[model samples]
Target: MHLNNDHLISLAETFKLLGDPTRLAILVACLEQEKTVGQIVSDTGASQSLVSHHLRLLRGARLIQPRRDGRHIYYHAHDQHIRCTLQDMIEHIQEEER
Candidate 1:
C-alpha cells in the first residue's frame, strides 16, 4: 500500500505519542479491561497528574476510548487493532528477553 504524505504524517504522530513510556503503560494497563485514572495510576505507579496528562493525549490520538459513569471516567483500548498491536509488541519484548 502506498502511503501519501498525510498518511505518513499521521502515522509518525501516532508513533510519537506511543513512544512515551507513561502513555504506553497507560495503554497497557487497559489492555484487558477498562480502568479509571486512579486505577491506571496505581497500576503504573505513576502520579495521577501524569497519568491524566497521558490519558488525554492517548484519547486525542484515538488509541483509547473513555466512558463516563457518574463522576468516574473509564478508559480502554479503542479497538482490537490497538489490543493486537500491543500484544504483538509485548511478545516481541518477551522474545528479546529470552
Candidate 2:
C-alpha cells in the first residue's frame, strides 16, 4: 500500500528528529523532569547552544512543551505518549538484539 504525501512527510520528519543524538537525549532528559535550558545543558552535558537547538527541533515536532516562569522557560515531554513510544522503540531494539 502506498502512503499519502502528508504521511510520508511526517515519517520523514520523525526520522530526521530521531537522527540526532542530541535531540534524542533532550527528549530523554525532559522525560526525567521538566527543566530549563540551563538544567538541560547540565543533564545532557551538551553546550547551551546545542541543547537549545535540539529543544527547538523537539518543540517544533510537538514532542515536548515549554512552561514559562518569570524570565526562564522550562521544558517537559508533551505527554506520556512520546515517553511510551520511546520505551517501545527501545524494547523493540532489545528484542532484536536478544
List runs of model 1 lying over 4 Å from the truth.
Answer: none
For candidate 2, lDDT tens digit of each residue in 1-98?
A: 89999999998998789888888888888886789998889988999998988888888889989999999999998888888998788789899888
- How well is each residue in 1-98 modelled by candidate 1, as lDDT tens digits? 99999999999999999999889999999999999999999999999999988998999999999999999999999999999999999999999889
* Model 2 TM-score, 2 decimals: 0.83
Q: How high is the lDDT of residue 17 in model 2?
A: 92
Stretches off by above 4 angstroms in model 2 are 1-3, 94-98
TM-score of 1: 0.95
Report the number of the highest-TM-score candidate: 1
TM-scores for all candidates: the values are 0.95, 0.83
What's model 1's overall lDDT? 0.95
Model 2: lDDT to the true structure = 0.88
